[model samples]
Target: MNQIVTFGEVIMRLSPERNKKFIQSNRLEFYFGGTEVNVGISIANFGGEVKHISCISDDFVGDTAISYLRKFGVDTSSTVRSKLPLGIYFLEVGAVMRPNSISYNRSHSSFSEIKPEMVDWNASLKNCKWFHWTGITPALCEGGYHTLKEGLVLAKKKGIEVSADPTYRSGLWKYGADPKETLSDLLNYSTIFIGGVNEMNEVLGSDYGDSNEDFIEAGKLLLKKFPSIKKIFDKIRTPINASWHKIRSRMWNGDEFRETTDFDITHIVDRIGTGDAYAAGLIYGLLNFDDFKAMEFGAAASALKHTYEGDVNFSSVNEVMNILEGNTSGRFNR
Candidate 1:
């Protein structure tokens, strides 16, 4: 069986209890989140052999993250335990005209202090068919960028297929180096490019059009520029309100662009890590199927993420298949 390994920071999300504001709330719900780590958990939940590689503090928050990943069947052997504490973020879910807000306090967390020598790249990626990562990892700090670059180089040297999601977070890139310089350097090693139009434009220095059609065109241009990129996956978002959203995705498979229609979700319990869920679904589809149906499958899985609360999507293969089969009635089970 093929195995996938993902590397990035794991944050402990502290969100206001219920629909209350952070200042008004006394209790906060805790959840484990990180772009690449969330993808690993989703892939593992879908029956994929997945491993998460990152450094976390030996603190309680780090332990919680480890326990959470283990519960989802993710291998933690590659995780390094440090004396530093885990990073954390505060989330305020929005309603009505207000939009969701997040405040981060992740300055010198264990993951940010990850040094290249701390990771045994050869051993971590051994027997792994696919190695995955995100641009956020490189934006953490100088050490973080070095760790990501080293991991990618090792994976390439071992002939392991690499997938990267240049998921740009402006706040996260507040370190010394600019994201454009770091991301451009990293893109040279990526086989799969995943991100939104704005993110691609910012990282690749390409003129991505504003509209979705133009975005697809820009993606095609990117594939032309980088011949090594076999596939380009993109997620489309249409916000109805603070509590409702329509999400979908498109893929340019170096030949033709395939798209899935917008999935209108009524109630959104949590919306933090939906993009990672979509990426995981896309990877699964690319590895398992050849047809364009993968786009729809990926879109359905992302839509299902809105119904649940937390960073990692808790969805099963059967539920995704049911949605793909056009069963959106959402009948309750006994």
Candidate 2:
């Protein structure tokens, strides 16, 4: 396999120690993460060659973030430095009936200041087989949108596969871009759609329910509108509470629809990057397995992420394969 390239901001996450609210803790622990980088790191853990592109502050904080990605085997050579500060978010981990909360302070951060000239996409995308992007990048700044669009257009020309995760957050779209229009336009360049009914409805302005039938219809309509999309994969989560959840994945590959069994996660350690884990697993599986098996791999990877702490899923390929093989006993491996 060639390189997998991810484009997005690297955010600094500050959280109060284990299950404690901000008010209850005197100090905060920090970790580096973002949706795209999280996926990159997870793929790297699975032994994929991944290159991450982004702008970080020209300071120690940015240095630490680069070191963090390097520690996870992600290539950060394309990551650039800016005089702006690094983006930061505060997360409040929840338990049982409680819920996690987040506050962002990233508007003026280094990533938001990214320009198209900052990254030489032609060189960064060299030897790249797959490119991954999320809607959060475009929502940040106009420059981000243009930069990603430049890469997408080139990726299409180069015959590279593109995965689009349109994680539309209304709050993040404060930069004056039409969320629906922006996402719809980007979808034209994407080869795989990585979202569910809600994202579909948001981008298409359709009122689709959560039933399987509704999902199938929405997916078909999506492919009809965006002819470039070859398949659709969605990760469905049934959250019982902050501590436990059930996850499954479904897919529509042009002619057939496939779904996976639920992987129940009890006593969740962290829920931050479960979706990223699913995306990473899907990418890896698609590169090596059939569509149905890839969807199952994605669901299992998502279930495994809840067992680990922080924003990146550090679970190896064997760990994810164990879940696929029905070895969820959390047994000690000596």
Candidate 3:
């Protein structure tokens, strides 16, 4: 059994050529990505025993996804295969003054239609110490919602620590009930919560501005509302351009506030899925180190994600430790 288990959908991402819109691109790049799956891949790359639990289509695309995850040493024995088609999305990477856009075509995907009995919860998470999920799972469909609830219940009963990322996607939840009600119900079972202020406001029905003060107040209010939650990890971002960004993060760990300095990244190969990488890094640090060290490790991991092309972070544990030790000189190998 692995130490970590993550559950979510896996989709094949098709992104347009550089500096081109979806309509103008003659060819697109293909990669397999999902929030939870990305986190699992990152953890596995850092030598963590990670298992991914999700439904995949019994097709070539599904096989490709499984292979991609296995390349990073992730365990996929608990994954199920169904007859439904795999989900896909088209991404348009922004340039200059433009912003990136994603158009998903994933209705009735095998993972979205997953039910409670489809997964062997007891065996899959028997020796797991940490179980992870995201808001997108419950927003998939009513069946997905029940399945996620069942997984959470089983994980709690088995004494596994659970973490959740409230990555609220408005379009994904259109087929189901309101995101607010659904996410609130799930948060009750979550031990660690990760999201931005905008997402928190959307899911928790709060009308707050985007300022440091607002976020601190919101964090205090949220902790009071959700007593089971022990920590809130917030990723802060500042866009310098389409190809550059400045990133930092802060954590509200029940008793004290901790933050890391901004990391200025000059080249961004792919901006998508960095948040998931940060979450995975934070989870690793929290499991192994103290609170302050965890925040620095997580921020450094997120900074490293900008240099990679795909969504899954490919940096090693040594690289992350070096960055956490304040070696940002970027010296090449001797």
Candidate 4:
């Protein structure tokens, strides 16, 4: 198996219990997840050799977090335990008419305060075939951004493939750095860029509108700027209500543009970590199948994730492959 390494923050996701709104709930349900780490867990569930790198408080809470990663078969040897606090986010699940909302309380998190010395990138990535990260890391804090940047540079030096989810989180980018500049610099070392057309304007300084043609043009502009990018990964999402979503995925692999079949995802169990699941599935497909098949697998994998209750997709390879083969009825096996 190809060893994969994902570096970023892992948070305690506190959502209102029993699908209650934030104001109506008295108790919150907690789950462990983060963008890059979620990707690691999803890949691990599919029998991949993956490692999650993050910083957590040096206490029982941090140890528990590491334990969960280990339970999912994700190697935690590179995780750092520090004296800082753990990052957290409050999620409010949405209903038929209303939309979902999130409030972040991750300021001063151990991962946010991660220093360059805390991560031994060379040792951690020595045998890594793929190194992964997200734009959310750079948006967190200067220290986190630098730490990720150093790792990415080292990955390039070691000839390891690099991938990123250029996710645009306006709420998290409250730091001093400009997202456009930060993403441009970090994406220079990336081989695969995962995000939508809107990110082009939000983080890449492009002036394209929402049309499919505009998206394609904007993608071309992006490829021109970042010569290292060999593939562009993205998906289309349609709102059927707060609880239902219609999704489809697409990719451009330098010479070819491909799209997957539309997937109608109804009755979402948990609204978080869909992007990470998609990214993980795409990476798996890219490594094991053709470019177009990879897109289809990624889309199907993420659609199945909506039925799960947590941030990580525990769906197996057989499950995802079955969905790709038009077995999405969720029927029982005899």
| Candidate closest to the true structure, highest TM-score | 2
RMSD of each: 1.5, 0.8, 1.6, 1.3
- Please give, for residues 185-266, the per-residue lDDT of candidate 3 as tens digits: 8888888988768867876689877787777778888888888888888888889888888888887766777778898888
Output candidate 3 Cα RMSD. Answer: 1.6
Q: List the residue pairs that clash in candidate 2.
A: none
| Per-residue lDDT over 5-48 for candidate 2, one digit per residue giving the tens place of the 0 to 100 score | 99999999999999999999999999999999999999999999
Clashing pairs in 3: none
Model 2 residue 269 CA deviation in Å: 0.7
Show where candidate 2 strays beyond 4 Å: none
Each model's TM-score, in the order given? 0.96, 0.99, 0.95, 0.97
lDDT of 1 by residue, 137-201 (tens): 98887888998899888777777778888878788877779888888788778898877788778
User: Pick by lDDT: which candidate is best?
Assistant: 2
Residue pairs clashing in model 1 are none
lDDT (Cα, tens digit) per residue for candidate 4, span 238-290 = 88898889878877665667777799887888768888889999899888998
What are the clash counts of all predictions, listed in order?
A: 0, 0, 0, 0
